[model samples]
Target: MSIKSFAARIFASHIRNKIDKWASNPHNTQQKVFEELINKAKDTRFGKDHEFSEIKSHSEFVKKVPVRDYEELKDYVDMMVEGQEDILWPGKPLYYAKTSGTTSGAKYIPLTKDSMPTHINAARNAILCYIADSGNSKFVDGKMIFLQGSPELDEKNGVKLGRLSGIVAHYVPGYLQKNRMPSWETNCIEDWEDKVDAIVDETLKEDMSVISGIPSWVQMYFERLIDKTGKKVGEIFPNFNLFIYGGVNYEPYRTKFESLIGRKVDSIELYPASEGFFAFQDRQDANGMLLQLDSGMFYEFIKVEDFYSENPERLILKEVEVGVNYVMIISTTAGLWAYNLGDTVQFTSTKPYRLIVSGRIKHFISAFGEHVIAKEVEQAMKEAVAESGAEISEFTVAPQINPKGEELPYHEWYIEFEQEPEDLDKFAELIDRSLQKQNSYYLDLIEGHILQRLKITKVPRNGFQDYMKSIGKLGGQNKLPRLSNDRKIADKLNEII
Candidate 1:
C-alpha cells in the first residue's frame, strides 16, 4: 500500500512539474493550455478506472454533466460512507473529510490518495505566496499552526472511524513540520475530537509565528487565549506575523480579530477543500494569486448572466463575463469530472483571472422578497461603515420575518466594536441608505418598505469569537459563515437584538 501510494504521488509530482513549466511560459495562450489540461484529464487514472471515464472530452463532459449541488451527490456520498469502491474509485477512499453543506446538513466529502496532493500543493503555494508577500522566503521557518477539521471519519453505521488527520499527516514535508505538536496534528491520522484539542493545546504552548485557519475558528482560539491568560489578543500572541485564513469571508470579522491580536498581521486567502486546493492569494499585491488551475484540476466558470437569463448553459473559464457571479466547476485527479463546487465567484479581471468571492447562490437572503444578495450586503456594509465615519469591528446581517409584530420582514445587523458609536440610530440609517443606493432592486423594495426596519445590536467586545467556539468549530475547516440565511439563525439573532 505504501509503495503504491508513493508511486501515485511521484506521478502527481511529475505532472505538477510539467504544469509549472507550462504556467511559467510568458506567451502560452490560455486556449492551448486548457486544451492540454483537458487532454491530461482524459488520461489520468486511479487504480483501474480513468478519472471522469464517463466523459470522452472536456466539451462533452461540461455539456452533459449538469452543475450538481450536494443533494445531487448524496447517493455518491452514501457509497463512500458504505465503503463501496466499484462505482467511484478502485479501492476504499482514504478518508471522508466532513464538511457542512447548505440544507444537506453535515456532508462527508470524499478524499482519496489522488486528491490529497491538491491540498498539500495548494497550501505550499499559499505559504510561498505569503513568503512573497512578506518578501522573505524563510518566513515560515518559525512555528506554524493549521486550524482544520476533526480527524475522525464516520463509518457506514455512523461509528467513528480512525482519524483522517493521522492518515494524511506524514505526507507533509519534514523540514517545515513543528516538533512540539504530536504527529497527529500534521499527520491527519488522529481522531477528530482529539485532534482539535491537541492542535489547540499545542498552539497555546508555542511561540507560534504563523497561524492558518478559518477566521471564525481563529477568533475562538483568541477567546480561549484570553480566558487562559487574561491577556488581550495583541498581548497574548503579539509575535504572530502572518495570519492566513479561508473557507469564509474575513472582512466583517477582521476588525474584531485584529484588535484582539493587538496587531494587524498580514493575511493570505486560501481556497481549498477535501476534494482539492484550487487557488491562493498571490504574493504580489496587484496579481491575485493566479489560480494554480493547471495543478491537479481543470477549472470552468459559469457566467452569471447566462445563469440567470433563463438559459441553463454553463460558461467555460475562458468565456466568463466580468462582474457577474459564476459557480466554479473542477475536474480533478481525484475521481471527479465536471464537478460543481457550489462556490460563487466573480471575475475582477480576465487577463490573469483575478476574482472576488460573491457568496453562495444557494444561501442568499430572499426573505420578505428583498433580493439582498451577499455582494449587495457586503457593499452596503462597506459603504455604511465608510459613510458613518464610525468604526465597525465586526458585523453580520440576517433577514428576519418578524413574528406577531408586522407582516413585513426586516433586516437586522449584529455588530461588535471596541467602542460604542456616538449615535447608533444614525449608524443603522447610514447602512440602510447605503444598501438603497447600491442595489436598485433593494432600493425598489425599500421604497415600498417591503423591509420596514433595520436594527443593530451591539455585542460585548469579543462576543463573536465566543459564538464560534460554542459551535465546536475552531480553526482549519469549520468557519463562521458570514451570512447564515437559515430561518433559525435569523430568528435567534432577532431574539438577541
Candidate 2:
C-alpha cells in the first residue's frame, strides 16, 4: 500500500476503536459526558446561577436551566464580548463566530478554547470514520481544498470576530496545514469573488485529492476552474475522490455537482454550526449522521410539533423517538445553557443514535394555512428536477399573498437554472404536483381553491448572486432560506430580477 494509505489506515483504526467503545453503550456515555461538562463549569457564573453545584442529575439540571434562543442569550454574550472572563465558560471566548444572519440579524456565537477542540476533533473524526468505513485513504496523501471564509479576524471588544469557516481555518492542524491548499494570504481575502479566483489560480496545478465547502460556493469554484482550464474537475484533479459538504442539504445540488465534476465522488455530510460540531456521517452505508455524544455539548430535544405550545415537552436522547422532528437544545462548554439552535432534526436511529436535519424553526411557510417546510420543498424540487431533466443552481420559495383581491394567493418560486427544461410550464407543474403530494395542507389549499397554483418565476442568470453581492452576503456559510412566511426575501428577489 502507498504511504498515505498506510498512515490513513493506522489513524482510521484508532478512531474506529474509540467510536466502537462510545457506540457500545450510548446511554452510559451520554450521562457521563453531561455530568463531566456540568462539573467542569459548575464554578462559572451561569452554572452557579443555575444551581449547578447542587445539581447532581440530568433531571435537576433540566429543572434549573430553561430552554432559550439566541435573542434571549444575547445579553450574556454581550457581556462576554465586552471582555469579561468566566461569564459563560471558565474564561472569555478566544473568538466569536459571526453567523450569516439569514433568519435574524447576524449572531455572535462564542468559541472558547474548551469548545474549539470539539470542532476540530469532530471534523477529524469524520474523516477518520470515513477512511475506516470506505477504505479509501489516498485522498489524504494529496492536497485537500477547503473553500472557507476569510481567515482575517476582526477584533470586537478585545475579542476576535469572524465566520466559523474562517475561525476553523486558523486552527487546522500543523501537519495537514502543509497539504491544505489556498494559501493563508488568499484565504484572508475578504471579497469572495476575488478569493475564489485566487484559489482557482493557486490550486489549478496542485494534486487535489479532496474538496470541502458549501455546495454553492464550491460549485462556483468548479465553474471557474473549468473556465480557466477547459477541462472537467475530475480530469483537472485526477486523484480527487471525496467531496465533504454541509451547511445545506446536498440532494438538490447532487446532479448539478456531479455534472460539473464529470464523475461521482464519495461524500460525507457534517452538522457543524457556530455553537458546536453536533454530528457527522460516520458509516458509509448509514443515511444519517452519528451524534457526537462525546463532544463537550450536552443535548436535549423538544418535539417540533410541541415547540410553539405554551409548554413543550423536552426529551433527552433516551426519550427521543425515531422519525419525530425535534428542536435541538444544547448546553455547551462554551456557556450556552439549554440553548435552542433553531435548527430542526429528526432521529433516524435510536441505538448509536443518528439523525437528519429536517429544517429550520423560523424558515417555514404557513400562510393560507398550508404549512410547508424545507424538507418538503427540497423533495418537491428534487422530484421536479428528475421529471423535467432540468438542473437548478439555486432557489427560494415565498408566499405571494394577493394585494386586496388583485390576484389569488399562491407560493412564488424564484429559481436560477443551470440547464432550463424544454418546457418551463411543465417543470413548474411537476414541482407544484410534487409539493402537493408531500403536504396535505398545500394539497387542500389547491384542491379547495384557497390558493392558486404555485407560480414559478425564472430568475435571470446570476440574479441570486447579484442579490447576495448587493446585500454583502455573497458566500461562505450564507444561504437563502428555501421557504419564508414573509416576503422579505421575495421582495428582494423581485428587485434583483
Candidate 3:
C-alpha cells in the first residue's frame, strides 16, 4: 500500500477505538449533557453583558431565554456580510455557511469562532463512535479520507469563503486539508462552472477510502465511477473501508450501494447543517443515538400532530416518548434560537433518544385523501421492486388528482430500468401490492377504490439525474424531492407525462 494509504488506515483505526470507548460508557447521558449545553448557549447570546463569561449555575440560566430561529439572525448575517462585528458572538464571524431552507431560497448561516470547539468535538465523537461500532478500529490506523468541498477562494480576499460546503472545508484538519479534491469536482461552487468536467476527471484518480456526503451525490458518483472504471466499485476501490452518508435517509439507497460495493460498507449518518452538527449516529445498528452536544445547543421536540394542530405543544427531551414522530427545534450557540428545520423523526428508544427518520413534514402527498409519506413510499418501492424480480434504475412519483375533470386522484409513477421486465403487467401489480401492504392510507384507498389506479411508466435511464441537473441542483446536500408536493414540480412532471 502507498504511504498515504497506510497512514490513513492507521488514523481511521485510532478514531474507531476512541469512539467505541465513548459509546460503551454508562456515564454519558446525552439528555443530561445536552441540557447543560443548552443553558450555556442561552447565556452566551442573551446575557445582559452580551458575553458568556461564567455560567456555573444551570438553574440561573435555564428558562431565561426564548426559542429562536433563522428569522432572529437575519440582521446578524447581514452584519457579517458587510464585515461588521459578529452579532451572534463577541468577535467577527470568520465565515458563513449557506443552506437552502424551506420558505427561503438561500440562507447565509454565520459560523463564529466561539462555536468552533463544539463543531470539532461533535464531529470527532461521531467518527470515533462509528469505528467502535463497526469493529474496524484497525482501519483508522490508515490515512484519513474526506469527501469534501472545493478549496477555491474569492479573488478579493484570497479566502474562498461563502458556501456552506466551503465554510466546512475551511475547518478540516490542517494535515489532511491539502488532500481534498478541487471544489470544481462538485457540480457546485457558488458560481464557477468552468471546471466541472476537470473536477470530475481528477476525483476518479484520487485514493478515497472514507467517502462522506449526502446519499444522492454518492449515488451519482457510483454511476460515474462504474462507467469510468469499466469495473464494479468493489474491484476499483478494494481498500475503501467506510462510507459515511448523511444529510438524508440512507435506507432507500442502502441495498443498491451495498450490492455495488460487493461487501458491507461501514456507514455513518450525520445530522449536521450550515447551522451546526447537531447529532451523529453513534452506533452501527442502533439507528441514530443522538450524542447531544448539550454544550453547543438546546433541543425541543414538537409532536408531529401537535405541530399541525390548532394547539401545538413542544416537549422536552425527557418527556419524549419512543416511537412518536416529532419536529426538531434547535437553539444553537451561533445565533439561531428555537429554529424549526421542518424535518420529522421518530424515536426508536428514549432512554438514549435513538431516532429513526420519519420524513419531512412538508414533503407529504395528501391528494385523493391518501396521505403518503416519503418514508412509506420509499419503503414500498424497495419492497415492490425486490418482489417483482426487477431492478429500478430511477423513479419518481407525482400526485395527480382530478386531471381533466376526473373524479378520482391517484399517483403517476415514472419508472426507468436497465432491463425491460419480461412481464410488465406483473411489475405494475407487484408495486401496487407492495404499497397496499405497507401504507395504511394506500390500503384504505385501494379498498375504497377512491383512486382510480397506480400508473407506472418507464422513462429513459438516468432520467432522475437529468431532472436534477436541469434544475442546476444535483449531488451532495441537494436531494431530488421524493414527494413533489409543490405545484411547480407536479406541473413539470405532468408536462413530461
> In terms of lDDT, which candidate is strongest?
2
List candidate 1 stretches off by more than 4 Å: 1-58, 89-92, 101-106, 152-170, 179-205, 227-238, 287-289, 305-311, 383-394, 402-408, 459-476, 484-486, 494-497
List candidate 3 segments past 4 Å from native.
Answer: 1-86, 101-104, 137-147, 153-161, 175-200, 203-207, 289-291, 404-407, 418-439, 494-497
Candidate 1 similarity to native, TM-score: 0.79
Task: Identify the candidate with maximal TM-score.
Answer: 2
Candidate 2 root-mean-square deviation in Å? 1.8
Per-residue lDDT, model 3, residue 186, is 54
TM-score of each: 0.79, 0.96, 0.81
Q: How does residue 135 of candidate 3 score in lDDT?
A: 44
lDDT for 407 (candidate 3): 54
- 1-497: candidate 1 lDDT, tens digit per residue: 34433344454455445545745652344445445545544433321233344545556655555555667767766776775654444445566666666688877766666677767777766665444345544334456676654444446544234333433454568755552243453435334344545555666666677777777656666766776778775565556777888776667666667667877878888776666776777654653445665555667777544655554666666677678778777665555555777677877766666677777766576665555667777777766665655555566677666545546667777787655557888878877887778667667877886766577867666565455445554344544445656566545444444
Q: Write the per-residue lDDT of candidate 2 for residues 19-128, one digit (tens) a residue.
A: 88987788888888889888888888787788889989878877888888988888788788778778778978888999855345778999988899999999999999
Residue 84 error, candidate 1, Å: 3.7
Clash counts for all predictions: 22, 0, 31
The global C-alpha lDDT for each of the candidates, from Candidate 1 onward, is: 0.61, 0.88, 0.62
Worst 10 residues of 1 by lDDT: 43-52
TM-score of 2: 0.96
Model 3, range 185-281, lDDT digits (tens) per residue? 4534443233334444666666556667776566666667787778776667676777876766676566677766777877788776676776688
What ranking emerges by lDDT with the best candidate at the front? Answer: 2, 3, 1
